[model samples]
Target: MIGLAATPEVSLADEPVRIRAWGLPPQTAITLRAWVRDEKGDIFHSRAFYQTDTEGKVDLEQSEATGGDFRGIYPMGLFWALKPTTPYRRLIKWDVMGSPFLVHLELYPSVLLVPSEDHLPAVTTVVERWYVAPGVQRLQVRDGRVRGALFLPPGEGPFPGVIEMFGGLGGLLEFRSSLLASRGFACLALAYSAYEDLPKFMPTVDLTYFEEAAQFLLRNPKVSGDGVGVVAVCKAAEIALCMASYLPQVQATVCINGTNAVNGNFLTYGNISIEGIPYQIERAQTTHSGAMQLSFTLQDPRKPEYQDCILPIERARGPVLFCVGDKDQNYDSLFFANEALARARKKGKQNVYLRRYPGAGHLLEPPGSPFCPVSQSPFFPLPLMWGGELVPHCTAQETCWREMRDFLHSNLAPGTKSKL
Candidate 1:
């Protein structure tokens, strides 16, 4: 019989799973395969080779990953890293936030011995989806100011609140906020532009709009914190930092792969005008592997424009977490993080923490998400390269997911911790 150690249902994407096979011929060689489906209904598969001991038993924990894109002993890692054989596309898509996916595993003979049964041994594992937390209220949030969904976790009076913003791609993505709400925090996926009812093109960012979102989160009856936190990625990361600096309601901020300066178009705050560091179109190069490279400031930090573009994040309040990838091809995440850290430190602030992942790419997605290498643009129409190879990319996703959850929970939710 083939079996799994943990429950057939798992909650976290990076949770460890143990698999075992026994009752077969001693010293037998076998192949184990898994199949799963994405929300798009795309079927994906992964297979590995293993050998049973004299006792006719094979424990995946003790086995080495041999024959698949991932060559590690962790079964969960194997499933997370599975890729197609032909063009090597991701075998699974873990981006269906709050939705569950089913997985099937089968054990087949490496070399058929005597054709005993008509079918191979099989087992099943279910990854359950997480919706809003019990008693949590899911509401449509549309005001003259903010446009997004608000998820309020089930609770009595007050709860920590967070305002989530997506990167330059611009549409309001509720996955992160929904997942966070399931973990016991009120989260709002705020959309500023590029979606229905929002601006079609990027505009000069105004902090007032984000400030309005923060105020909205704070006013929620379920929201308990003195000040709300902000979660943002890519270009939005800069916006988060700016909010933390300008808005007193922003008690904390998590900036991922963000720039140190006001990037893209110019940003305004009343009479104070902040200059943006424009992309060096000429310096942007594409690798032969089809990944577009960026002109990060690290390549030339001394450039006169770099100094002029830095944001005054030192004025921000509360703890800040800067998560960045060292191998990012999108921007100089490491350099920008360092600049932010230095600025915070220079201001005598000690709550800033910089978490750097080496060998990882620009795309630091939530846990269980299949590592994505290329992303399509909403306008210009070219696949932008998010850095890092398969192994490190997935690894970064797995770890960063937990880190983000804990950071927000610990800082925002403080006394009340989620069961996760």
Candidate 2:
């Protein structure tokens, strides 16, 4: 039997998170256990066990890959040490480290009473065939002369609109945005830097450009035109938050793994340059031993200069959804969520929904890959290393998908009560 809601003081970092194993006899092999996963829900955590001595000392051991993280390459032999393995429950596993004699202990947030109703959709086939479903329309739009693709649901006299942003490293991946558009939305995947002729490197981004994009989406007939919603990931997350604060057309915003404040220098799109961004971000470096490189802003979060970035969360005119990963080494998703939530509450706003996963990392969506962080894979010392573990049986992937879908539906629903 395993302990329920047991809080273990372990941080799942670059190396496998270690725990102080208790009640082990010296000179004997005992199980070492732990639980971890990444955002995409494709990988699982494993427990490798080491032997113990008679002096009540148990070396952290390894075992077979017994939990959710290893399902992608399972049965024949995923990789597991002779260490302790975890048991599976609610799609999450805290390893007894695959030891036949097992026990599980977990802490808050990592422990959710997953209702059985929320299982992975039986449609297990990979998404290969792309469809321009029921209400999707192709439109070439410009934000201050920068052109991008837009997808709007047909037959909508007036519907909610959303402006989506991909990572600094990827292109306008129309596949996912089109899916959202099919679900009755005016979705646009916009790119500002890194790709084709946009900009040679990560250029300074402007909140006004997204503002213009929102305006363009609202003006479209398919969109409700009242205002549009925004979704952002990685570095773009902060820009989405800024959109909600500075732009009137933005109603609901979802931010994942992004900077909370405008700590970097302002980005210039076209000839117009927006200023006041603190130049404080520093990038992390990675190592061959699997440690990540980290880049972050130098501005202190506690200072007034950084308040402009913090002001948006407090001033957001619409609802917000934040998805954070506890083990995410880059973008401190959990911390950002809490900070934003606190700021919102201080301003007497209560419409913030924050979801936290223990081992989920950045870059788990819209193209999750095997790289430590696919963006940093090419760089020698990968920047902003993270530690969110992808679970097997697709727990993180499935759960995050469900939570995010519900959040968008509930908040951005058609004909809800919003003054806009």
Candidate 3:
């Protein structure tokens, strides 16, 4: 007889689970597999080979994988190592509020690197990974040019407020906001473009629109503090910096793998317009896998000709946190981060902070999400390589997420303890 189990079968996506097997043959080889379907019905799976202990037990926390998707004793490796069955597809939780991801785990009697459909599992179990907690309420906002979803914690008279934005794939993403709300924030997942009646492309973004969104959060009755924090990644991170620089209501900002100088879009405010650093399509390198490595496709903002492209972040009224991945293949993230840091410091600004990850990618998502190094990009003709080693990228996500929460809490809701 063989048994498989996942303690606390249901858990938040960021939370860890304990997996173990009992009643297996001592010293026997086995294959453990995990599979889940994305919102598009695309299948993503990972498998690992392990040997049962002398006591005929295998604990993911202690057992090491001898072969398969990943090696070593990473308890949650199966969850993060998932790769899409369809080439170039990236796993995204499109309907985060609708349902949790149903992850199926199976145990096979023998080691099989690529298990066939005909092979039946000796034991199996299912686990649920949730983004929104039970009591969190999600509200769709379409208030006066501010189009997005607002998530509120249960029984919250007031909570730290956060405005979250994603990169070039401009659309409202609720997973991060929902998870933050569950952890005690009144979070707004803002959509700047490419959704509903918003602009179709990044080039048309107006700074006033983001100002309106920030004003909405500042005026919300459920939101605590006089100012709100901004959390953004990729291209949106540049916009967040703009908000922090010009908006007094923005108390803190987190910029993840973003460029210091504007790129791919012209930014406009009331009377000021800044030209973006143009993309040099000729510089894009095609990988052997046919994916495009776009790290060098943008004109160097540090050059004398592109001075206007640099954002005036030194004028920001709040503390800024810049997170960069040295292995980022989206652009030169480290260079951008360092440039921003140097400029802010040269201007005598003391609140700028930089956190560098050695082996992470362009898409630094919340923890427990699958590590996606290469994926199809809407902005390009071929799949894009985001560039990160698996274990290091996963590690960066987990560490950055916790620090982000603490930074927001400490700055936006001073004197309040972070939930982490």
Of the candidates shown, which would achieve the greatest lDDT relative to the real structure? Answer: 3
Q: lDDT, candidate 3, residue 161?
A: 91
CA deviation > 4 Å runs, candidate 2: 1-135, 154-157, 195-197, 267-283, 295-299, 366-386, 392-394, 414-420
Q: How many angstroms is residue 390 displaced in model 2 relative to the true structure, after the best TM-score fit?
A: 1.9
lDDT of 3 by residue, 206-254 (tens): 8888888988987889888788899999888988988888778888999
Off by over 4 Å in 3: 414-420
For 1-420, candidate 1 gives per-residue lDDT tens digits of: 554333345554444556777776788777676666666566666666677788877777787656554565755654655443334243333343445556666677564333244756554444453433446577878876688888877767577899988778777777677777877778898998877787866668888888888888888888986788898999899889888877888877899998777776778877767767666677777767665566342344347856766776777767788999888888788888998889878988778888898888887876655556665565534557777776777778778877887787777755432221
The weakest ten consecutive residues by lDDT in model 2 span: 120-129
lDDT of 1 at 288: 77
Q: Model 2 lDDT vs. the true structure? A: 0.52
**TM-score, prediction 1:** 0.85
> Model 3 scores what on Cα lDDT?
0.89
Q: What lDDT would each prediction earn against the true structure?
A: 0.71, 0.52, 0.89
- RMSD (Å) per prediction: 4.4, 13.7, 1.9
